[model samples]
Target: MDTNAFRHTLTAFRAPRPGAAPSNTVHRSLAQRQRAAVSQPWLIGASLAGLMIAAPALAQGEAALPTISVSGSQYDADDVRPEGVTTATKTYMAPKDIPQTIDTLEVNKYKSYGINDLATMLDGVPGVNTNYDMRGEGVLIRGFSADSGDIYRDGIRESGQVRRSTANVERIEILKGPGSVLYGRGGGGGIINLVSKQARFDAKSSVTLRGGSWDNYGGTIDINKVVNPHVAVRLTADREQAHSFRSGIRNKNEMISPSILVDTRTGLRWAGQYTYDNVWRVPDRGPVYGELPASVSTHQGFAHPDDYVQDRLRVLRSDLSYDFNPAWSLRWLASKREASQDFDHVFGGTYCNTAGRTATGAACNYRGQLRQNYAWQATNNKTTTHTLDLTGRVDVAGMRHELLMGLEHSSEERQPQVYGTVPFGATINPHNPVWPAKPAQRPAATQNNLHEATSRALYVQDLIHLAPQWKLLVGARYDSYDFDTLNRLTNARRAASGDSVSPRAGLVWQPTAQHSIYTSYSKSYSPYGGRGMLGVSGAQDDEPRYSRQMEAGVKSDWLAGALSTQLAVYDLEHYNIRYQPDAVNFPNDWAVRGKERSRGVELSAAGRLAAAWYVRGGAGVMSAKVVEDRSAPANVGKYLINTALRNGNIFVRYAPQGHWYAELGVTHTSARWINAANTQRLPGYTRWDALVGWRTAPWTVTLALSNLLDKEYWRSTSMPGAPRSVLLSANYQF
Candidate 1:
């Protein structure tokens, strides 16, 4: 990627706009209105208003009040609370004021722990789990699966299967529960939004080098410069190449991100950013059957050394904001994203029988129990998205209100040029595997297909302050989705279209600035694509699956707002789930009379326990089950697959003095069913991590040790936890 190309792209969108200055009369009117707003006693106040209201009631005699200051960092040590999050309401509001469970991880915090991967960074979040899928990394939130499509960058949906890097990330925010009102055509599992770093008026630069076990090595550069008082530029880049613990696996990645910020005297500001990423890695399927005996090593990967997947991503975004007055403002955002992938792999199969093995010998033998099945897929997938959002805030009838309206258009296309499925000529034992010789020629390519989808959506949300201590939120969205599929082999084409509407409502009450109680209800939907799924071919296609959630929570700040805690309970259900009645049946074997439900309680706390000790962690207890399944009656009342009854993690850091600190953390996950039938299970496991670091004026060094006990366990059904590994990093700042 050329740095000059980024400059050209940004200049194309920076055309000047002509405007007239406000007249003297208009300025006078604005000043009078600002004065009136300030005089209103019941209007929205700053965070300190809560402390002042509770001081008389909660403070002891002669006890001096702790001084507090609002800093520029998203989160400051003075108060563990975040400045605000936009994903929940499309407007900046404190996390405690939002009626949903929102979690945030600052870049500095994760960097200190030597966490590089997105999945590892989310390990301690309550009610969230990592799962594996053929498409990409999968996330389970509140017992519902959230794919890559559910992830967002700066509030815009990011599609495709690719690993995310934190080199240019400022913070990561997770919004829990149904989100269709703001994001269309998604699951009820919530969304993950990555906020990128932007240019500031101040000049800053840093470089970091990291090395770890498994031949891991990487370097990153972040540099920012202020061109003038009104303009600034920033660039972030990184390159990494490494081999994995799994045999025959290697990883490589490179990324470059450039951004610019422009501020005009007319109260208008624009921020533009572009990112390019290229990633190549050999995909690992982990051990077979979701488990391994002590005699079998977890590093045994079945995929051949030649199998690999490569991905490239490009994203461009622009945000514009103007303040009309002290009480009114307008914001507009536009973004475009393109992603492509190339994959080719031969993987193991899951079924084996003694009779077939005897007849086929080497070809049919699959470790004695499972049969050898070889699958190969070579295809190209691309996704292009364009989105626009308009948001405004004003005071109406002495009440503060924020309004958001948005439009989105997206298209995705997949072309599969080559696909092959056949039994390999050789098989090996799991306990003592033998390498097979490479085939002279690749398998014949037969099937060719193309799939494309286009979607459009309109959404609106409003946050109204009914009183000084009370607030209400309401939102709705309508989506239109169209999909087309063409089979080159059969020359057959199929098209489907569907529509959905989602709505949400919430109410919040803040008795004091440090305490809040709230309840909310929301709805979400996922559309199904195919020929008959929507009655396009004179057959009843499956209707879109719908999910609803009802939640109540209490949020509070303690120790003079230095710590924050939350307790929440929620009930969520998904309806119209498609289930297969009989595996042998040809058509009409699937039905939509299936439902799944999950109810859980979550407790979390993060912040400073004392002046020298910092604590962050949370726990969740969930009960998830298949409430109804007409097609597969036996699955009714069974536990949901891959969902644990209990999960939690806690980390503590102590920095009594000097420039050195030590940290310890533990993560625990309870046993969970591997399948919906609840027959096979993955045992519960616990892992420990430790970190130590020292900082000088311009240099910092750190070491992180993971899996301190060398615990051997299954992270997911087919994914094994990594063995003990160590990472050391050094940073230089200017």
Candidate 2:
């Protein structure tokens, strides 16, 4: 049936009062009985008799309860039915029905926490860690790092290679453990999918302005409008800037995103989105070991040498879903993403010479032993993807079940250009560090081309119900990937391809209405790394390494699902792998023979504790030791990653029914080594942030203080400690 016709029928069917007697009913209308027979051919015997008996009530403005709500498929946390899981899984398996951990973060959570970025918000999730580099942001789950190919948006594959902002997200789902059975790539560690906000049936708009520390200021405007009953569009734009804090570094950012959704009268639902981001910054060059002047104290502030960087990114995606029937549906998605970055670094800007050769006190010279150097770098790439999925429900033996089948394909084209420049300078005396400058010399630029030979996958899963309280899930997937690269300078091209079959099995048992237990095993595969991370040789798919995981866990929900918790134990194996030496030491070199492994356990807990008070937190402790490192010392035994040992977080929230709210959060990170040597430790530390907010209709004011204690901590694997800073912001929604 068509959408409008279906809506009208449903509306009429649910409009009448219960037990109302029929008014226009005849003993038996031939047309009505014929239509009912055609619509519900499976109804028979007693069920057919019952429907016939109730036909008068239906025709008389007396109907049964309506299953559809104004909120669509979304439901309030407190209203979820017991033992009924979300359709995110074909069978609506309760959390317990899925052995692995799958955490869902709703839009309401982001509103309450005021979280606008994935890194900051996900920090509260258990087993999730983030590494903030000068270049961008990266995350690690369960001690394993995030891969570029593992990201998704609304069930569609996303490069997620851009590290700009997460303001456009409606919610985020972090599925723990390998998910190759469902999602083909980068499932070794797990995957985090960002679901973008959509234009709802109702129209809503908001605009916010904020200002904070370090000269940081920004504003955002988001609007959603329903042009007609079946069409809607949303637009968002924001800009932010910050300057000079611990060092004389400056940063600036701007973003614009727009999306349109079309709900047609036909059974088709579609949405298209486009995002543009640009960021520019001059990062601190940091200090060199033993380069200080005698009169200049370490505590004294100093400006960094020339360091500038600019990044631009663009993303476009279209998603579609068609409802063939109430119990069956299909979805198709397509997307394109691209990014470009430019960087320049200059050193020896009036360098000071004090004990330059030795770590000792000596006469300080402002000019001796000085030289100027410059370097330029750039990277550009683009990717396109397509996916088709079908979902349906079935019944066997007296129990109901769900099944999902799908196919995916993606192609990427990348061209990375490398360039460098050097300028001549007049000779200067040893007493003067500044030299006469000359025009900069332009160096040769080389462009390299890389192409992904389209990765494809087909998979199907079945959720079997043996009883009302028990379920079994069985699934398998066939994945294929091909890749090729051309060296622009050398004109060298190479190609490779491979495929794999993965299987998954699990069982869930619900001993009580609010609790469930399950165990499962799944497999995952990826071509070592995607085209971007892997060099020409590593891009070969001939022997794509694979990873396997075995997990079993229990989940509990109480207080009508307002409060939830999960406990899981897992063992992960990464095989047919290759390990490269430290990037800092080896730089661009590749490792021909790579083999390594990591195995460990993870734990986490989250959700609300009470109405006015909410608590969401998690802890991850693991023993992730590298089994082998061909370049490491023989007696080293294992390369134990200290950073993978432990990570924890906790948050307390208080919001009354009035117009005020407050929240405080504490985060802890364990010390990790910079490399396998284990001599240098990252120095574990704890930090806290707090906020107090007020809201009255369209006006919302907030006082936020991050790093309240101004603690000195470091997150850079290269740098030991990072100085603390603060930001205070206020925003208004209209």
Candidate 3:
């Protein structure tokens, strides 16, 4: 993104309150220009056609270049080149030098396939899975669920687990394994950073219309303009509606995201962004529990006609940066996020008795349905975070060192209201049923609570260039965390505080410019806060749960960085896992498990294989088990829930010098346990997909077919995979 080419929308920002930064001016000429890479060139898809036309400028008027028609960007070497990333560390580090494995999902690929939802956008990442359950959509990295705190936007934690929309997203970065040394309390799982597209100096705009099977359709508008050399603005909005393969389920989603960039006379570079999103959908419940009869089609749905889930969110983020010299700089980031959601669900009928048994203790001729219930819940969440990072370079005792010191403060308040379900007044056989009568009256509120938490942290890191071939990276962080929970239902309150220290160390040996070998150990922590911070449960008031990992890997670049590859093996353990201490006597008392362990290997490759061929995706194999839990001695050797043993995804694309291209993709996930008892499983599945597109100077059109075989399978323990589907997308630029 630092390149001369305007191929990327690169002015990303992280900041504190809109006006919290000092107004003092600093010289910018000598400071390293700070920019986050929000684009991946190889994924530009049909937009590659436009890049080829602009290649002359990228060439610097050098030798005669190969002619590329209005088709692809394979020959536009400079614009399509892969660049260093900033996620693994706060500073930019080349792909071959990162000690931790970070995987990226670029923008172009999803747009090409008409993907708009977060779960769909995350389809092929290795060691990561997306799950849609009654609780809401969630992401699991290496079998550990990423709580709301672990999902960040431009490195800032989001407000809550609201529905996710890609309308404002530019790209995604996943830092695998333990990373608590940076962010404070969170899931032990990896981090998911959603980078939003920022205002760009180059003027470009587009309008796209998309339509797909199940009556899915949407339109988007993107406008970027250079108001002047010192300022720029960008706006992107989308409106989409869709029907689902699950009978009777439907959706309507909307998003408006805008960003502004400013270069003040004081040498301060500032960027601000805002997003407002609203979503509504009737969720699918799949099938009744323990009743997956062959006669039931996957498309069957059992949701109540009136049941629905809706979420709305507003977020404001600002960044102010200044460069003191080529070797030193500082960036201040602030964000405020608010989310509100309401959910209502009705259960599908469950079998009540054996086919020939009756409630009266007599033999019966037919199976009947159990009485079902409808639940109502709502959440209101607000979060604010500020971070200041000072980065500098210096020579310490003849060894060059890259130093980063930072501090962060964040606060959140979550109010959750729960209304326990009311039983339906009627019942019908689940296997062959008709709509049952709705409950005549709802029940009293079961619980109402407000939870507030605040955290302060200081962290420091130094990357020492010990020699030309070796680099050592070391960092540590300390946190002061406190929380207050109010039981609104009973007008009672509880307060607690805890703290932890996390550390990381990594050594990179770049034996050659193209290849590097790295090994590292890192530790992180997760407080007692609930996954979405509604409250804390399932654990005692102890120090934050901690996780550690030891990893070794090799990274390499090919064809002058047009392609990148990595292979890594790791062993990770999470300690203080929650367990029941005395469920038989004290049903609410929860204790801790001694430990749980997971070991895995992963291989990934991205970028060009040759002029016309490109590849991206990876394969991961892991085995996760419960090491010890004295309270539950029977579970000591069982496999962890939802941790698949093997998963693989691969995508290959071919684009000629002409005006047409094609791609093929495949994904595989091995069966894994889904319950604590390890008695149920989410069946493994293999799926195939394909895409074709054609482009010209100002127009591009693509057709994508997913779930080509329409295989019947479950994506997670609770949801069924979508059957075969098709999408047709087109774009025009002005």
Candidate with top TM-score is 3
Q: What TM-score quantifies how close candidate 1 is to the native fold? A: 0.84
Q: What is the lDDT of residue 376 in candidate 3?
A: 78
Candidate with the larger lDDT of 1 and 2: 1
Q: By descending TM-score, how would the candidates be arranged?
A: 3, 1, 2
Write one digit per residue (lDDT tens) for candidate 3, span 1-734: 00111133332321111112211111112243253321111011122224322331221000000000011123341122234445667665554657898887765676666677776677667887776655545677776777555776666666564777777676677888887777766666688777665565553677888999999999888787777777677787889999988887898999887776666535567666667889998977644434544555667677778778898988766566777767777876656678888887776434346555543355544455545567777888887777788878888888878888898877788888878656555665555556655556556668788888787888998988788778888999899888777878788776668888989999988766667789999998887663423542322254467888999999876776567788999998889876557767874466776888888999998778888797878999988888897877788878888778888788788877876878889998888887777887778899998888877657777888888887878887547888889998887776
Candidate 1 segments whose C-alpha is farther than 4 A from its true place: 1-81, 112-114, 289-293, 326-330, 349-372, 378-381, 384-386, 417-421, 438-447, 530-542, 579-590
Clash-forming residue pairs, model 2: 578-594, 713-722
lDDT of 2 by residue, 471-509 (tens): 788889898877777766787776767788878888877
TM-scores of the models, in the order given:
0.84, 0.77, 0.87
Q: Write the per-residue lDDT of candidate 1 for residues 1-734, one digit (tens) a residue.
A: 00110111121111111011111111122222222111100111122223323331211001000001111222323123344455787655566668899887665556654455677677657888776554455678898877635677666666654566666665678888988887777778788877666565443577888888889888888787767777667777888887767777777989887766666746666566667888788877644554334455778666666677777777655455565764455554444556656666656544344444432243443435432445555445455444445555677899766676776666666665555556655656655555576566656657667777787878888878888778888999998888777777777776668899999999988777677789999999876652222111222234678889999999877776667788999999999876445545644355677899999999988777898787878999999899998867899889988788999898887866677778888998898898777888788889998888776557777788889889988777666778998888887776
**Regions of model 3 farther than 4 Å from truth:** 1-30, 33-82, 288-290, 352-371, 421-425, 429-433, 437-442, 530-540, 583-590
Each prediction's whole-model lDDT (CA): 0.65, 0.54, 0.68
